[model samples]
Target: MEINKKSQAGSLESSDLMVYVEPFNEIKIEVESSVSSQHTEEIRSLILNELEMRKINGVYVKIQDNGAMNLTIKARLKTALLRGAKNGN
Candidate 1:
């Protein structure tokens, strides 16, 4: 059976990021980093992976990272995806 994925709880710290995981949408990304390019890349990669894993396609993602760690970024992305998926955003 195809289980419907619902939006998960959002994190207050990563509340700034708005990621939409649905059909027919754009992938928008914006970063506010005091970190290095490599770190940013890592976070970006992780986000992409998370989206793919959730089987979500065609959506825009806006990330405003404030020197957050990799795990934190992932959590934020997950929350956004869950929210978007559940709310049909």
Candidate 2:
């Protein structure tokens, strides 16, 4: 599916996260984590898997991770993606 516009979910609160989704010509994923660099790759993989599972493409995903677990991040990503795709661009 294609993202129609900019959308976001989650927040920068402690032990939480924020996700931003926008329309783009290509899939772009950016991640910033407060935890540690060691978890970056894992988190990136998780985002990729989630996008792949949902067949989402041609969008930019910006993740600001504040020590959130995979489950939380996944939920946020799904919500943001859906919101971004809600209206036709």
Candidate 3:
């Protein structure tokens, strides 16, 4: 669980969230957000789509949000992916 490098991106602007992507060809998603239930579901849906599209696993994502928008969520997810890639995910 070491974040050796952080992508050159801004931080999340909402609640604190942590995502762990396992290594595999399957779509496995786990999210922890401080947003409301509806918003959480929305975010989960978006994240699932992203993970499926990217096909990433064996990596973990941790997000500290501050009321981020859809774009922000995408940015944060990409940042985490970049970081995980750099760190040999």
- Model 3: residues >4 Å from true position, as ranges? 1-28, 57-64, 86-89
What pairs collide in candidate 2? none
RMSD of 1: 5.1
Error of 1 at 42 (Å): 1.1
Candidate 2 lDDT over 1-89, as tens digits, reads: 77888999999998889999998888899999999998878889999998898788788999999999889999999889888885523
Candidate 2 residue runs with Cα over 4 Å from true position: 87-89
Ranking by TM-score: 2, 1, 3
Work out how many backbone clashes candidate 2 has. 0
lDDT of 1: 0.55
**Top-lDDT candidate index:** 2
Per-residue lDDT over 54-86 for candidate 3, one digit per residue giving the tens place of the 0 to 100 score: 765434344444456777778667666666554
Cα-based lDDT at residue 78, candidate 3: 68
Residue-wise C-alpha lDDT for candidate 1, range 1-89, written one tens digit per residue: 11144333333353233333333344444444455677667767777687678766665565656566676677767666655664544
C-alpha positional error of residue 24 in candidate 3 after TM-score superposition, expressed in Å: 8.0
